[model samples]
Target: MGNGAKAQQRRERGGKDAGKGGKSQLKVNEASKSIVCGTCRQSFMTTARAPALTAHAEKHSKALADCFPDFKV
Candidate 1:
């Protein structure tokens, strides 16, 4: 294939990968850090991988709320 064709192919593949649920997977490069939700006082871990972090945060919220009814934020 010509160089231009190869480049186009690579771009297309990259776009497809990005279109997938790339947000859910945890990226290895970013450090894990705590995130404080503005809506709640509870803190949760966040990472470069927003999808995984969001999932973890939601789980934390549910567990905390279930364990303590009075839990706020």
Candidate 2:
């Protein structure tokens, strides 16, 4: 794929470790770092991988936006 296509793909999957300045706010150390549910504003523990944080997202919605492979922008 060309650079444009790769960039679009990265933007579509802008989660942890995807690339620089991703949509995910997940972090490993600080408790202050966490991701919030867009619908409810609920807070979830920050994690680099989706499995660690996918449960709560799954509870409210099927798609794990900014947490898993699901894209949220």
lDDT of 2 by residue, 1-40 (tens): 8999999898788775556555564444457646666666
Minimum summed lDDT over a 10-residue window in model 1 is located at 63-72
Compared with the true structure, the alpha-carbon lDDT of candidate 1 equals 0.52
Model 2 steric clash total: 0
lDDT of 1 by residue, 1-73 (tens): 8999999999887895766664553543233535554445554444324454456457667543343343244
Which candidate has the highest TM-score of all? 2
Cα-based lDDT for every prediction: 0.52, 0.59
Question: Can you give the lDDT of residue 9 in candidate 1?
Answer: 90
Q: What is the lDDT of residue 25 in candidate 1?
A: 35
Candidate 2: how large is its RMSD? 17.8
Clashing pairs in 1: 40-73
Which segments of model 2 are wrong by more than 4 Å? 1-31, 66-73
